[model samples]
Target: MTPNAREMSESIHEQMPRLLTELAAVVGTTNVLTKPSQQQSYVQGALEAVTDATVAVVIPHSLVALWRVINICAAFDVIIIAQAANTGLTGAQLRMEIMTGR
Candidate 1:
């Protein structure tokens, strides 16, 4: 059966430390933004909505890095939401939680 929200949250909480470390290794430590302060700009919406459920805001520097990031998230069963640099007409980024276990 599919894991419930609470179970998924707990599982992700347990795996986050390792996941962050591995993600940092793949994308470089500088590319991984874990703190809310550091990640705020990335997830900020056009209408002033801010999603605080992000685990980390990973900024991949290249196609290779992006590919690796996808693989890592897939391995951890994490969700991903790709956003353009300055586009959010539909508030897409404000929707689902990226890298969230749920």
Candidate 2:
């Protein structure tokens, strides 16, 4: 099983704000959604919808931003669930309530 944020490192709470800022900067603020309502649609599968568990749903419109996002998440030890048009039927992109950055 994939470990949640708590199981990872306690340092994530301290790094999340900076991580978010960098993410927004790389992808633009409008593309980095932090609200539950904005996050919901991104976590849905073809059959069921998962609860919003992500601190932010970052949408990178370019490969450069996507690469930087991966790097930023690694630097912060944050888990990533990559989504593509939310068209998966097997819940592959459905993120669990596995992170607690705050």
Candidate 3:
């Protein structure tokens, strides 16, 4: 992708907050995270993969917010990664490692 396309991609990503806010009508202005730093980290790889999951992460305090986030991602055809647990090195007793869900 060229720089112009990259700029357009970023602009599209920037609209997620408005979309999420529309879905989660109960959320206040302060609850939404418009910046990347406000989000949490999501890296627990075992092979020392410095996976820069450097994206905004919104933590829902209630079921409403969670539902809203899910709805927004689904409507936008976005990918959601859900992690259950990490066994450090042992791969036993692990039913599901990570859910690369929709």
Off by over 4 Å in 2: 1-9, 93-102
**Model 1 C-alpha lDDT versus the unseen true structure:** 0.80
Model 2 agreement with the true structure over 1-102: per-residue lDDT tens digits: 966556555567677789889999899899999988887777665568445466888999989889999999887867777766666543664444445432
Q: Per-prediction count of colliding residue pairs?
A: 0, 0, 0
Question: What TM-score does candidate 2 get on C-alpha atoms?
Answer: 0.75
Per-model TM against the reference: 0.83, 0.75, 0.45
Clashes of 2: 0
- lDDT tens per residue, model 3, 1-102: 444545645765887666656644546555655454553333434644443433444456678777877777677655555444443532222223254211
Best by TM-score: 1
> Candidate 3: misplaced stretches above 4 Å?
1-14, 20-36, 43-49, 83-102
- For candidate 2, the 10 contiguous residues with the lowest summed lDDT are 93-102
lDDT against the true structure, per candidate, is 0.80, 0.74, 0.51
Name the candidate, 1 or 2, with the larger TM-score value. Answer: 1
